[model samples]
Target: MARPVPVNLALRDRRIDIFFAVVFSAFTVTSIISDLLPTVGVDFSQPSDNFFVQSNYWYAHDADPLFMNPPDWMRIITGLSAFVYMPFYIVLVYALLAARNWIQLPSVIYATMISSLTGIVVFGVEFFGEPEFRTQNAVKFLLFNLPYVLVPLVLLVRMRKPLPFTRRF
Candidate 1:
């Protein structure tokens, strides 16, 4: 077996990876605040009763009313984000910081899942949902949620090669 050569990846030059690390770290927190909270029984049905949702304009805006109504499928995805994806976001924060290559498969999976969930399921609910379920602020909703799709897609492409951290965009 041939030994793989170690690439000297300078963190100073890896600005984008650092951005990804910060974003994933932020996601780690949001997974808890946004997704995990809902899964753990903090009701989103009435933002008036939910402290975070009530206090935060992002949630209170009702941009994505799915949070307010949260059907079974939405609950499932929130549970998934809380239990599965939240952990990944934590690991991803560390992985991106350390430039670890092993995160490729898991990140790809995360990207695909997030893209499909937000890109298809979420947007579908927001755009095509019954009037009651649709967002009152479609632009704001899309602006806030777009990163969930765009960032993962960027990471998906970033991880396409071996030693992904060594590669620069």
Candidate 2:
């Protein structure tokens, strides 16, 4: 038995997947440092210090409110991102880079999960939460968080066919 040859991240043949890999890798790092660490009381969410969220995500969290002082459901969502999505993201990055067919099904589930969580649940709260909970700034929310919804959908289309990496796009 022979192992499949895995391409490096910079390979041009899988341009879109390479792009996805880069974007997802960024999200993974940000999620771990900004989102996950804050959830664990790491104190990095404070804007005066942290560079990643200093002028961007911190403001969005303050504007949206659910991110900082989340309700029970939001807490569960955060936990899911931390414990579930985080590991999946790491593996997904590897699978994308390695062109592993096994990632297709998991990517499907992740696409559905993330798109719903971001596009519906998070937006629902931002748009319809009580006066105190609704987002103070809609533009920032969209700019900062839209990718969580859009990228997964793109990944879905990318993974639609069998052995997605084997096909040139």
Report the Cα RMSD per candidate: 2.1, 4.2
> Cα lDDT of all candidates, in order?
0.80, 0.76
Error of 2 at 36 (Å): 1.2
Tens digits of per-residue lDDT for model 2 on 61-130?
5566667666677767777787788888899999988888899999999999988987898898888967
Q: Which parts of model 2 have CA positions greater than 4 angstroms off? A: 1-11, 41-57
Total residue pair clashes for candidate 1: 0
Clashing pairs in 1: none
The candidate that wins on TM-score is 1
User: Which portions of model 1 miss their true places by more than 4 Å?
Assistant: 1-3, 47-53, 56-61
Clashes of each: 0, 0
Tens digit of per-residue lDDT, candidate 1, span 51-126: 6766433573557777765778887998998899988888888888887788989989999999998899989988
Per-residue error for 133 in candidate 2, Å, reads 1.4
TM-score to true structure, per model:
0.89, 0.82
The residue-level lDDT of candidate 2 at 83 comes to: 78
